[model samples]
Target: MALDGLDHMELEESKGGSGLRQYYLSKIEELQLTVNEKSQNLRRLQAQRNELNAKVRLLREELQLLQEQGSYVGEVVRAMDKKKVLVKVTPNCRVALRNDSYTLHKILPNKVDPLVSLMMVEKVPDSTYEMIGGLDKQIKEIKEVIELPVKHPELFEALGIAQPKVEWST
Candidate 1:
């Protein structure tokens, strides 16, 4: 009976030990899985951080480029291939336009107003009158029609406020 009791006690001890080992093994596996998931999450966040950092770096570079003062300050002397130009930056130096610098050239077509100066009051140069020697009859006709109204002004009173205005042609 003593030998049987010893064998029974050993059998119970083995069962308990096996059960504890299995529980510990399962816990270790679960902990390992949790650690792996956390590590993957950390790696994903790090990668996203790296991508965002790269985009921020690009934006900073672009801002720096835009903020830089333009070195070319001159007229577009001539155009070349692919939006390039020869610019006169100074009295002596000529520069080739680079990196799509067309600010000056692009303004020329829209900025010019040829007829704007016609409203200005000006004296007719004497050299222009000296050039009209052969058109004697025509000049007399012109002086009668144009200068008569300006110099005399009594003719318009006879016509009764119907002022004669000459239209100029370009």
Candidate 2:
């Protein structure tokens, strides 16, 4: 009788041990799956962070270039009131006019003020001083006042004087 009882107890313990092992294995698999899912989520978030960082770096570089090249003024001009027709001056000092279609038309000028108003913007002349026959003396005087400084800037610098500016009177 004692031997039979001992054998029965051993059989029950063996069955319980097998059940515990299966349960442990299932738990480990579930934890591993959870860890894999979390890792994938972390990777996706990191990729988004990297992409945003790259975009911010590029924008900062572009802003720095604009400021360095004096094109920041153009940005300010673009930020003005939408109703006002503003003339945009490029960093290279080109005048940008708006056409009938509301498109920017870049016009190269011999000289332009960056702060010139839209009302003050004028079309480039197709005529020259020689085209006028009787204005020789007047043209010579105009050349001395205008062309002389442009042709020989050092002369004006030596004289410590700037070129004469003509102001229109109403």
Question: RMSD, model 1, all Cα superposed?
Answer: 19.8
Winning model by lDDT: 1
Show the colliding residue pairs in model 2. none
**What tens-digit string does per-residue lDDT give for candidate 2 at 31-141?**
999999999999999999999999999999999977652222221144346554354444444444443344444545545555775557388567888789998999999
- If candidate 2 were superposed on the true structure by all CA atoms, what would the RMSD be? 20.6
Lowest summed-lDDT stretch of 10 residues in model 1?
Answer: 103-112
Compared with the true structure, all predictions reach lDDT values of: 0.68, 0.67
Report the C-alpha displacement of residue 48, candidate 2, in angstroms.
Answer: 0.5
Deviation in angstroms for 82 in model 2? 44
Model 1 scores a TM of 0.39
